[model samples]
Target chain A: MKKTLALATGLAAALGLGQAAAQVSDDVVKIGVLNDQSGLYADITGQGSVLAARMAAEDFGGSVLGKKIEIVFGDHQNKPDVGSNIARQWLDVDKVDAIADVPTSSVALAIQEITKTKNRVFLISGAASSDLTGKACSPTGFHWTYDTYMLANGTGGALVKAGGDSWFFLTSDYAFGHALERDTGAAVTAAKGKVVGQVRHPLNTSDFSSFLLQAQASKAKIIGLANAGGDTINSIKQAAEFGIVAGGQRLAGLLVFITDVHSLGLKTAQGLVVTESFYWDLNDETRAWSKNFMAKHGGKAPTMVHAGVYSAVKHYLTAIKEAGTDEAGKVAEKMRQMPVNDFMTKNGQIRQDGRVMRDAYLLQVKKPEESKGPWDYYKVLSTIPAKDAFRPIEQSECPLVKKS
Target chain B: MFELLGVPPQALFGQLLLGLINGAFYAMLSLGLAVIFGMLNVINFTHGAQYMMGAFCAWMLLKFLGLNYWFALILAPIIIGAFGILLERLFLRRLYNLDHLYGLLLTFGLSLIIEGVFRNQFGSTGQPYDNPLPGGQNLGFMFLPYYRAWVVVASLLVCLATWFVIERTRLGAYLRAATENPTLVQAFGINVPRMIMLTYGFGVGLAGLAGVLAAPIYQVSPLMGSNLIIIVFAVVVIGGMGSILGSVITGFALGVVEGLTKVFYPEASSTVIFVIMAIVLLVRPAGLFGQTR
Candidate 1:
């Protein structure tokens, strides 16, 4: 009887040790959706991105390897310091496996460095600077959605090809704007077009009358707005008021979003061509997913950033499941090896430089008479395939991409 | 194509007109700040939020009540002013006996609450206020929008009228006298507290009027005033926050200076005003028109 009792105690201890090991290997997967929650960029990637991320987790069966998935968010307020601090705290304290949907480029760059040091995944969706993949690419960072290169090649190249060649840029004086202007300028030049002039405005400028007048005086065929969010909306509205278009000069919103188009209304934003990676009305799959998002998001349609968050989160979970662990390096490797097929992208492949190569659309804002429901804002002009839409790998400056 | 200062005449004139419009707004807002600061001895940090409220009030009036721009012009200031009076009675009156910094802190907190509430409801995207006076005639040198021209003229009139009422009227004399010795004025049965309340209300009302005027030109957003208020404060600082006429003149002059900077060096336009403020502080700390305290 004493020997049998001792044997039972040994078996119980061994079983307990095995359960502890399993728990350590398959803990909860926590994702932090950090972006501008209360500032200018909030409209595009605020609570909506958080909701999309949650939906992605739910769609992924809510758990991976028996660990429940959790989504958390923070408001970076478009400040770099604030963002990096939150990222460090999330990584160190909360054990967040990934950070996603960082919008502003400066903040995104700051968080990217932190994620690199911690070996956590950084899913960039809202930010538009191509420098993420160019000079700042990280093994753990994935540039999932649109970037400045895509915008420049889509809107700038299309406009130049369509004879709206002479360009004047009203650039917001910052990293994002500078990258956008550089890329668009290159695209214009590549299309055999001339850039007449450009003026750089400070971020969050309330007035653009003086800048618009300068663009008008240049007599550029197109006024390329190298700004986004509120700046883009204000410049476009003032341009309309100043009769910039009526004076025979067109306005190209290089980084305009659907939110901006909604704010401007079709009456004023008409005839302006823009580029986007995902439009809610693009197809049946996008329509269904966006409708689901809108129902969860107070009838607000999902921007590309929100949609990209959903896709990135879903893809990240898939990678973790395939790798059978939450080890950042292993999951990132699996992510790179797998092709991204989702409602947001079809056969989207992650390049070595970390840019998600996917098709982009050049769209024109519909006129008021374009009969449709409230969210039907775009008329698709053209589609640039994934190969032609992004910067070529040979020209990449990212150290991660080796020379062929 | 005539050239002025290495820029085309059309561009230069257009920038000048734009500057004048901006100056008009500065003059109105700074004048309000001066009126409140002169009498109440509080910085009225809520001045910007009040200005934003005026614009939002105009927007709400149009959206909910189907009121036109003209009606909003008349009603928004009065409604916002009434709210200002209530605020003074409930909160600001208690801070009058405390340090000036307390008043500033209180109003700063109030401004945040007001701005936050609006942001929560509307988000940051600006709503368009249709141009009441649309289109413009092409001048020989530049195109002039009728709405912009109206704004310039109306703001000038409003500024001058505010100046006249404060510097020239009997009520103005009483208000100014109360500012000097509130206790003594109270002994004379002049009801100094009521005067202080009215002064604050009137000052915030001026901000409201400016908001109504600015609605068509700027997208009405929660941040509309916060963006412009910092510049107006600099205008007030440069003008010396002393005499009403001083703030008005300084506001217009600095606006022209900023516009000229944009034409010559577009990059410096944003900082030109602050640079002028530093120069003014060094040369004459009391401001161009301020009395030495």
Candidate 2:
């Protein structure tokens, strides 16, 4: 009887060793969060993005397939080379199965190239350039939320429809701004509107008096400021001071954030129409989620890019869970096939080309006098359906598609 | 047709005027940098941060002290200039014996710390300053805001005035002589150390003055001076370091070229000035107006 017991113990030990090896083979997933930590995109996706990924991991029970999930993060510094190098290290050495929240489009595009070659999943949440899923589309990449095309179509088209037919563009002279101007111009033209003229200003330009005067002289019905961040806020404010808005033309913000509008206040920003994918105070679920987010983010409301980070990280974890193994190809496939569910988005589906189809919102900044509370700055003018907010699948240049 | 990139007469002139406006700021900032470098032999990386601080100071003065644009126009520079003097006396003066690179590094670090603190406190969003000069005059081709025209004219006058002080005055002669032979100037009991400190303060004060003028036109933000300074550095290099009039001329010229690029290529607008800097470096390694010592 002693000999039989010893043999049984040895067999149990052998079985345990086999299980451990298999677990190592199938588990131990690593993910990377590479984003701008100290540059222009930092405010949108700095340490906050890392925190969101951690939150998602916690919500995922911190383990998948009986294997602990580890997330390593780095600052890409908003440079393409830096982003690609970090991606290479994460994929080759650290073996990160997926990368999330690459903010700058130039950096995001380089990372997409690396991920594609390595067969790793790359979810882009903060990049505003539409080329990510447009001409520069890659199989390994997913543009999770917001793009130039949607912004142009929503803000430009809506304003054009509202008899802002004659337009003057105060465009920033860069690839991003050029794309936005092109898309917005096309949208306005499609809506039977005329573009009077455009003045291209330098990025981060301080003075807009010359551009504003040019716009003023053009006498267009709408003065569309196709810029972002400080440039946008400055142009709009200067325009108001110059009496361009008060004189005749209306101000339309092609790309604006809750923070920018907040900083400008309703007096300067009021009556300006903008388009965004997410607003903190949209619905009961959003309000509740945003309350926590705002509290965590120091009472300032979440920007679209911030909300996108929250949603993309959550979806990525969900995909990893469903895939069982942390193989990039499998997880990406799962992400594409499955519907996305998160605080920022509900009933959202990832198209075959990896565009997250979600509703876009048209919002108007409220008058300061009309505000009931501190954070209540925007009034939702209309809800653009998911189908209308984004370009149709046929317009996409992505080669991979379902058999349908 | 002798036309520049198919641009109509009105459009070309309009871009030219626009370029002149941008060049005005570039010239002023570069002039200040040259003055500081001439006296202290240190590249003020903090110049950008200081310029940003100047804008923020003006904004704060308006918000907290109920100071209007006119008062800020006067007091902002004095306050910031005194701060510059303090910075130099306490910190920069200690580095005079070291390699010039050390001073650059220290200033760079200081800039990072200042920018970081401002970013942390105020967030990345910009605060607007109302235009002090309320109205604009309608030109034939374009409506010129009075404040913008004032910025160009004021910046030019300040640049010229600083050049006059440094190039023409007796105090300027002492400052120049001291830069040439510090020990000799010190032996003459001219108080060279105090003069150096005051020079730095004066240079930084120019940046602050530029900032105050800029507050109404530009959004007051921590990042306002960073990218602008890089271009100004390029402008300085292209104009030849230590050449006041060169900076003013090159600043305006590059601005016009950049404006023209916007009309023609558009994609190269941001990069045109850098390209010019590279070209100027190849043609004249010491810069178009710089002495090749």
Candidate 3:
């Protein structure tokens, strides 16, 4: 009985120490980098996000409050249940104060719920669903980078205005695709264009002949592809084979990355227009950072997701330092109130709805014979200012907002 | 220029023909899965990776070995089949007595490893394989691409030939007997273990062959098979787990249904196959043509 009592006392002391470490810890501020390490999003954000986060930590001098800052990471495997469980573990056991760089929207939504429940901060950098800041907005969450609305408004609105007015969509059949189609369709209508018809293709569809034939038969001026990854590449390639492009119908890729354009080669993907929040060759700073990033990562260019990771991590750390505490509510308030400053971002501000205000660039894929160096795939035709790139705050459906 | 149900004859026929082409792939893949499950009693989860590897093999043969598509079409499956044999002998054979779930887990792990290694080497972007037969013969309503026609015909021949070998041959009789009672087959002085190994190898080769055919149409990538395999699995279960011809028929039928769904209600195009599987389970319990045994 005496030994048992002594053991219980020792356990209580250990528990007390753990609580003290979590609450009044002086040496380290822990941030969780939750993302898909080995799934579809992996190519966009996986190890590169981790490296980018580490670079941010290093840029922050690796320590804050006379203590070191550390990042803990886990692969959610693109499942919401797994992602939520990981977030819970990170918050409760790992004592993570902030989470960043969640790529999958479903996973991001699940994690946002967990973070909101736990009163922990979440900095979403990679996921593109507009719901992050719209209906699912949280006081504890800040969507730092891109979203579907920005993409649709930037590309769709611009393309519609450019006289590719009539559209026939070949969309992937999924939540993301549905959302993109809806947003882009609205943008097209808003810009005085019309959708002649639309066809839903299965996600990761190998063949696009049927869908392409539908688009061709529609005789629409524009063939809008609301898909990503392999589906987009295949549709565009087969469309070329079917002589659809030769028939004078333009192909608009709503969501495309530099990597995909590279894979398709400029010859095939030429004249395709896309909108992005960041590019590696934008300016001197972007080029310098990208050159180092590419050199470290085997000469592969950094996609928007990679750049977002770096910028988001840097901003989150700056917020954490400004707040002087790892508390989510406190840090989130400071994040919104403070101007977001980073190498990739210039005078960006986080709105009350947690949407990070930034410019979106419209790029046209350069032809192979354009006589440029390697990785010079895009020619920036226009830059959509931050205010115009995303849907206005008045149009947002977030319930959290009150019309003052 | 005849119009039917708001779709022109050319467009409707073209969609139907595309549906048939997709059906061929579905039939071939599910047939291989059913054959593998029939004898090995293990769901080859790495079937997709093996399929992807087959395409990569064809690409590599062309890029490095100076071999063309026709040669790679024959040699790639053999090379992939040899790899399958080695995999079955070394790793898969060890799980013969455990719960079949272990085999699924092992193969799932192998799939991740194979896909990861490929992704590490080739990246996630699709690498285009040049179409060996580029031009198409102009049909009345539609232009039938030579590669598309070749794929449909080749998959049909392979599927029918496999059915013949399994249903009509005496060797297949012994294989079926072993599936029923391995100990009895062993007692009859037949090599049951070797048969099991060879069956897995053959099933994997079928997936590899499908991959080679798909390489020209779809870019050669590690992810080429992962998505298709899930739908094929649903096809297998809906067609009755171990029924060979049921899987083949169901695969083609479901593909056509999916294509039609795209034409009518495009929203359900991705989900129509799963919906049909759910319906089949509710109505037939053992599938449309599947037997309970």
Who is ahead in lDDT, 1 or 3?
1
Candidate 1: what lDDT? 0.89
A best-first ranking of the candidates according to their TM-score comes to 1, 2, 3
Measured against the true two-chain complex, the DockQ scores of the candidates, in the order shown, are 0.61, 0.38, 0.41
**Candidate 2: deviation at residue A150, Å?**
2.5
lDDT of 2 at B211: 91
**What RMSD, rounded to one decimal, does every model reach?**
4.1, 4.8, 5.5
* Residue B125 lDDT, candidate 1, scale 0-100: 80
TM-score of 2: 0.89
The fnat scores of all predictions, in order, read 0.48, 0.40, 0.40
Best by lDDT: 1
Per-model CA lDDT versus the true structure: 0.89, 0.81, 0.83
lDDT per residue (tens digit) for residues A121-152 in model 1: 99999898999999999999999999999999
In model 2 chain A, the worst 10-residue window by lDDT is: A17-26
lDDT of 3 at A316: 73
Residue by residue across B1-293, what tens digits does model 1's lDDT show? 56776787767777888888889999999999999988888888999999999998999999899999999999999999998999999999999889999998999999989998988888778677787887888886677788888999999999989889889999999999999988898998898888999899999999999999988888888888888888999999999875688889998998888888877887778899999999999999989999998
